[model samples]
Target: MNLKFTPLACLLAPLLTACGAGESDETPIAIPAYTLTVNLPQTGTLCVDSNQNDSCDAGELEVSGPAGARQLQSQAPGLLTSPLLFIPGDPAALILMHPAARQDGQHLTPSLLSSLLQSRIAEGTPPHQALSELLAALAPLQPNQELASLHRLQEFNLALGELIMAVLTQNGAVPAPPAASSQTRVWPGLFILLPELSRHFANGGDLLDLQARLEAILLQQQPRALVTASGVSTYSDGTDYLLTDEPADHPGQDASLKQQPLRYRKLDSQGQPLPDNASQWDCVEDLNTGLIWEKKLDDASSPRDLHRVFAWEFGPYRPTQDELDYACPNSEAICTTQQYRQWLNQQQLCGIGHWRLPHAQELMSLQHYGSLHQQGGQTATLDVRYFPDLGAGANGFDGYYWSQTLTPSRRLESVPLAVITPIFWGSDAGTDYPTAVQTPSDVNALQLRLVGEVTR
Candidate 1:
């Protein structure tokens, strides 16, 4: 992005040289007034090859012409012109300006020109041919405004050329005259998918048009799907939960699949429901035909220190009633009940059991959309209809949930090979929100979410 210019005085020094001709009276020769037109690629570097390796191996040459104009020559190809004037066929010259090397051993090439063009098109320039016509009108010599102006124009052309080349190459639509050979090879169509070119795709032309083309290509060459499984139920337990038999035929015997009615009560310090609310707890049904969940408060002094516990007697696992309570504590003093409940369902807690803390990796897995920032914070919304029990009120909480796994700086002495834990944000959380957990110590506490897989 940096541009440097040489001063006009330095540019004029060589042109002012004393003319030496035959000692005798000989007529002075006039230089032909031929215009030099340099065609530059849209986005590549330019340089002169002192060694003639067909590569821009040498440093950029400082070029000065008629008038007090000077320019730093770039590896990128572009036209330079002398001030219009009558002169001997041969004129004295000096290196007044040169292109700065941005990196070591970097050179210019036709491909670089193509890349530059692609970038310009992505930036909203019209078709390549139209842009080329416009660029052709630029004069070789920039007025004395500054050398930077001239260099910038050159760089612009380089960028534009690169873009044109990229699009043409990607679609296999480039002209065939430029055939691949040992010294120069045509780039593969797939090169358009590179990260560098992706910027072009994201910003080039109409979004709808781009999306259609990309989707068509992707569908034609479907990528392999990646499937993953986690949770303790998937590990080798005493029994296979997936194969467990249930009472599906007999209504009365189907208690194994029936859902237990949740009990609500107002309690005092002694753990007894208030006198008026006692009936609320008494009405709770055992619902034993299906799995059973017991909601209880962990002993205040227990090191586990959780507010609520949900104990699942059967099925994969269930969030401890304590966990739910922690999420929706009865009092604001205990925790933000409203926020907690919203997070629970948003993170998919209704179907799975044993809502223990999620591991760090499990938390990160929720980010199926890949790097958040790179996508400009745009992500698809999640479907809430699947988990009707989560209820309609559980919305708008775009925060990170914690995992059962702890990300320890050092391995735990008790478990040497434990996997590191990370927090994951639900798709509903939105990419703009930060995904971090808060722990009791200097570290942060992590929230755990529950999930179960179903094959359809």
Candidate 2:
């Protein structure tokens, strides 16, 4: 059977729309309620006779409960609260209940819980309370292997918190509660505490210290039950939990290194450097490098500084002259642009896995403090000059670079221009600017920069 899961965003979209208007105020709106019911079909009789006689019975017979054979009857609709249910010989079902229905003696559904989570987070509900309730809901679902599941729950909680914080911060509000101490109260009720703990630390709290405490507790004693990261003062198990100090390394570093050198080299397959026509350099080269190089220069000229020259001269690395043959195959080559694009569409990269042009938001996320500039020829608020390797070779010096991601508002069917700010190696600041290149066709190029996070 195919399992279906709804994105948390979609499930909460309605609630989000409703609360969006009143979000400016500190007060949370009262949650609305609704009721939901589920009904199961009756089992056929032939199956019951076979169970009773231990043989293939052709005629129908009444099947009973654990005690004895009895008549089977259809069951009335029953209130459902859990997001998942496993009924013997029945397909699982999900029921969604609203707050108003719950108040009228109805139980909450998993979807309802998800909705509440989104709503409360939007309303800037205190993290402690939000986390507590989340934990209470998840506690009953704990699996036999507690540690791994606990870690996953923690990660999920952290991701949710981060998303909420980002939304709140974008809307010009404080993401966290005023009372820092109140965080302690939030942990006991939560099913997953690690993510919340991580969020607390990420938002400027002592998370490493807390992690150490948790490690110590886990090592000393193995607790039969999962404990929230927040209230990890003692362990139920006699063994102490200790956190391993080794940091998790990223797999992207190798890919980044492999691609970095390509930024500097010139010449197509024949060992011929790029022609000086400058005007012809627009979008004719390899989609990824060509786009990068095109965005780096206004019109090719002498290096304004080391930065421009470096970025311009360094990339499109060549392994052998033959390797360049397929670099940017156009109609003139055996593999046309359409063929290359189709091939690219088949490949996947980054955590998103599928490599495609990025949307405008995904592209802009690379922007750092280095991309800022000042008005009227004065130094910009942020300077890219601080970065060390931005424009060092063939790559252009200082200009906006485009990302593959398109803008959010653009229709998925209609490809839009996408770009990012150039990295200024001269200043040591690695900043990316958000920008896009307009395209007549819906077709867009796919370019990706590899980045990874180190989690302990």
lDDT tens digits, residue span 1-456, model 2: 222334764466454433333332334445543234212222211122212222224442223123222322222111221121111221111111121111133222223233334233322233335445555545544423321232244444344334333322445554443121222222222223444554564565643345444434332221111111121122222232322222234222222223222122222222234553333221112212221111223322311122221110011211222222322223122122223223333432111122233222332332332233443333322222221123323323333333333232232344333334334233433444433233333222222222211111
Query: Candidate 1: lDDT of 51?
Result: 32
Cα TM-score of candidate 2: 0.22
Which predicted model would earn the best TM-score? 2
Candidate 2 Cα lDDT to native: 0.29
Local distance difference test, candidate 1 = 0.28
Clashes of 2: 83
